[model samples]
Target: GSKVVITSVPRVMVEGFLKEYLSVGHVIGTELHTFGCYFTGFLTSSGLVVRHRALDDYFGDRKPDIGIGTSSLYDHLFISSCKVSLNLGPMF
Candidate 1:
């Protein structure tokens, strides 16, 4: 089976929905601050997650098979990196 990964939303926020509804296998989102099994609803020390950087880290040297997103600004960065990309936006 092809691995489906979504890496733009906060993991703690949309992980369940993505998995259940979208059948997403992996999600790389903003890391929330946690203490002893408690979420702080705050970003981690590393700060806000950069989309392009995250994509580079996730893919390394292997370009992804596909990239899909709604945002043109942030999503466009990685979408172009994939072999195939779909921008679900009005402009696209």
Candidate 2:
């Protein structure tokens, strides 16, 4: 079983959907703005995360074993950095 790291999605949202089979052990995403128990629906000062940069920050000098993402231009750079990548197309 390979480790799955999710980047570029809201941490709260990913946390809810990630399950045991997904093997998602790490995440890099925008931090939420919150007041007490209430969410502001806004990101923290860091703002929205750039997927490729977040991926770089997560792995540092080492590249990830695999990258899986949608078949969109947005994911091109992120997917290219990995040792192997899968573009799951629109259904993804």
Candidate 3:
């Protein structure tokens, strides 16, 4: 009797392909503030740009502040940024 072996694709390779096919560039900038973390980068191959930010704290998770009056607004901005970046173009 004989047996056969199989191989599977690696996660990193898949992620790399997706990132490149998705036109995601190397993460060039990152900033973390009291409110959240901001990421900035350019899709080098397609010439598209992106800016992303994620809030550190959830709505009503902490004492209200003039700076944090509207958590929904920030959430919207973050979501829009991601959507726009991901759908900006068809990768070659």
Candidate 4:
């Protein structure tokens, strides 16, 4: 079985949009610190995109066959755990 997990540190609310737009089943993004309807512009916890801890929490008992990343260092935390990894480089 294969799974598409988007491990980013954007915001949890975006998970729904990404799931529908990209058709991915899982999303692991950072939780934004907010007060009422206002955003504090900071993370409630730590960023997930560049942290290996996020990967650990996301894929506890299972491992992905491949990992797609953007950098050699930051993204590699998630990439290195997979059987294979790909660096897509900068989006621009």
Instruction: Please give each candidate's TM-score.
Output: 0.75, 0.81, 0.18, 0.71
RMSD of each: 2.6, 2.2, 20.4, 2.7
Using TM-score, give the best candidate's number: 2
Task: Write down the lDDT that model 4 would get.
Answer: 0.70
Pick by lDDT: 1 or 4, better one: 1
Instruction: For residues 1-92, write the lDDT of model 4, one tens digit per residue.
Output: 53466555575668778778877776776677889998887877664464466667767866778888877577777788877889898661
lDDT of each: 0.77, 0.77, 0.28, 0.70
Compared with the true structure, what per-residue lDDT tens digits does model 3 show for residues 1-92? 11111112222334455456655433222222222443233222323212222122222233212121123443334334321212222231
Q: Which sequence of candidate numbers ranks them by TM-score, best first?
A: 2, 1, 4, 3
Show the colliding residue pairs in model 2.
none
Rank ordering of all candidates by lDDT, starting from the highest: 2, 1, 4, 3
2 versus 3: better TM-score goes to: 2
Clashes of each: 0, 0, 0, 0
Question: With candidate 3 superimposed using the best TM-score fit, by how many Å does residue 38's alpha carbon deviate from the native?
Answer: 28
- Model 3 compared with the native: what TM-score? 0.18
Candidate 4: where are CA atoms >4 Å away? 1-4, 46-50, 90-92
Tens digits of per-residue lDDT for model 1 on 23-65?
A: 8787778888998899988888877777778878877998888
